[model samples]
Target: MLGAHDSTRDAGRAQRWAARLAWPLLGIVISLGLWALAARYISDVEVIRAAFAPQAGLKALVHLLGSGELWPHISTSLQRIAIALLLAMAIGVPLGLCLGLSPLFARISGPTFQFLRMVSPLSWMPLAVMALGVGEAPVVFLLSFATVWPIMLNTAAGVAALDPAWMRLAQSLSATRWETIARVVLPGCISHILTGFRLAVGIGWIVLVPAEMLGVSSGMGYFVLDTRDRLAYDELMAGIVVIGGLGFALDWLARTISSRWTQRGKQG
Candidate 1:
C-alpha cells in the first residue's frame, strides 16, 4: 500500500508539472499561428509572404546563429546596456539618497527633475547627437538618461518610505548619520531599488534601438537598419525576434531577482 501510494504521488506530481507547462506552450503555438496568418493575409505578394513568414524568420535566425554573425551584434548591444546601467546606478543612487535625506535639496531640484523626467527620452536624440557627436557616446548618453529617472525616483521613494520608528531607534542609539544610513536605510530599501532597477532596464532597452541608430557601425539597431537597407526582411524579422526574446529574458531576470530579494528580506 505504501509503495502504491508513493507511485501515485509521483504520478500526480508529474501531471502537475505537465499542466504547469501546457499553457505557455499553447500560448506560443497560438502566437505562431497568428503570425503565420498575418504574414499570409497582409499581402498576396510572394516576396512579402516569403519574407514575413515565421518559418523564414526562424530559418534566418538559425542561419545567423550557425554562421556566428549574430553574436557580435548581440554582444555590442549588451555592452552598451551594461555601461549605461552602471552609469545610471552610480548617479541615481546618490542623488536619490540626497533627495530622500534632505528636504532642502529635494525642494530645490524637484522641478528640474520633474520636468526632465516628463520629457520623452527620444526628444533628446537630436540634441544628444549634436552634443555628443554621434558615436557610442551619444547612444550611451541617451540610454543612461532614459534609465536614470526611474532608478532615482524609486530610490528616493523607497528611502522616504522608511520607518520613522527605526530612524528614532538609530538616533536613540547615538548612531552616526553614515552608520544609520549604511546599517538601516539601505537594507530597508533594497527591494524598492531592485524594482526601480527593473523599470529602468525596460525603459532603457526600449530606448536602446533608437539611440543606436545614430552613427554606430554595429549593435542590433544598426543591424536592423542595415538589413532594411539591403532589403533583407527575413533577417530583420529574426532581429526583431532576438530583441523581443532578450527583453523578455531581462524582465524575467529582474522580476526573479526582485522577488528573491523580497522573500529573503522577509525570511530574515
Candidate 2:
C-alpha cells in the first residue's frame, strides 16, 4: 500500500509538471505557425518578408552574432536598465515607507503622486532630452520615471495593510520606533515590497527600449533604427526579437526572485 501511494504521488507530480510545460510549448508552436502563415501569405515586399520570415530573421541574428556588434547594443541597454531600476528602488522604497507609516504624509502627498504618475513617462522624453541632453541619462531617467510608481504605490499599500496588532505588540514591548519598523513592519510588508519590485522591473524593462532611442549611440533601440536606415529588415526583425526575448527573460527572473523572497518571508 505504501509503495502504491508513493507511485501515485510521483505520477501526480509528473503530470503537474507536464501540464505546466505543455502550455508554453503549445503557445510557442502556435506563434511559429502564425508567423509561417504570415510569411507565406503576406506581401512579397522585401521588408515585410524579412520581418515575418523566421529563416531570414534567424540568419540575420546569426550574422549579428558573428559580427560581434550585437553585444555592445545589448550591454548598453542592460546597463541603462540596471541603473534606472536601482535609482527607482532607492527613491521609491523610502518614500513608500514614509507614506505607509504616516497617514498625514500619505494624505498630503498622495494626490500629487497620483497626478505625477498619471503623466506618461514617454511624454517627458522631449523635456528630458532638452534638460539632460540626448544620451544615456535621459533614457535612464525615463525608465526610472515609468517604473517608480508601481514600487511606491505598492509599498505604501503594503505598509497600510500591515496588521495593527504587530504595532501594538511592539509598543507593549517598548521597542524603539526604528526597531519596530525594522523588525515588525518591514517583515510584514516584505511580500508586498517584492510584488512591487517585480512590477517595477517589468515596467522598467518594457520602457527601456523606447527610452534608449533618445539619441544614444549604442543600444538595441539604436540598432533598430540603424537596421531600418540600412534597409536591413531582417536585422530589424532580429533586434525586435532580441528586445522581446530579453524583456521576457527579465520578467521571468523578477518573478523567480519574488517567489523566493515570498517563501523566505513566510518561513521567517
User: How close is each model in CA RMSD to the real structure?
Assistant: 1.2, 2.5
Give residue 190's lDDT in candidate 2 (0 to 100): 78
Candidate 2 lDDT by residue in tens digits, 1-268 = 9999999999999999999999999998898778777887777675676566877887888889899989999988888888888888888888899999998998999999999999989999999999999877889889999989988888888899999999999999999999998998888887788788889888887777777777888999889888889878788878988999998888899899889988886787
| Winning candidate number (TM-score) | 1
**For candidate 1, lDDT tens digit of each residue in 1-268?**
9999999999999999999999999999999999999999777789989899999999999999999999999999999999999999999988898899899999999999999999988899899888988789999999999999999999999999999999999999999999988999889878888999999999989998878788899999999999999989899999999999988998999999999999999999
TM-scores, each model vs. reference:
0.96, 0.90
Q: How many clashing pairs per prediction, in order?
A: 0, 0
lDDT of 1 at 164: 95
Candidate 2, residue 124: CA error in Å? 0.4
Of candidate 2, the 10-residue stretch with the lowest lDDT total is 43-52
Q: Name the candidate that leads on lDDT.
A: 1
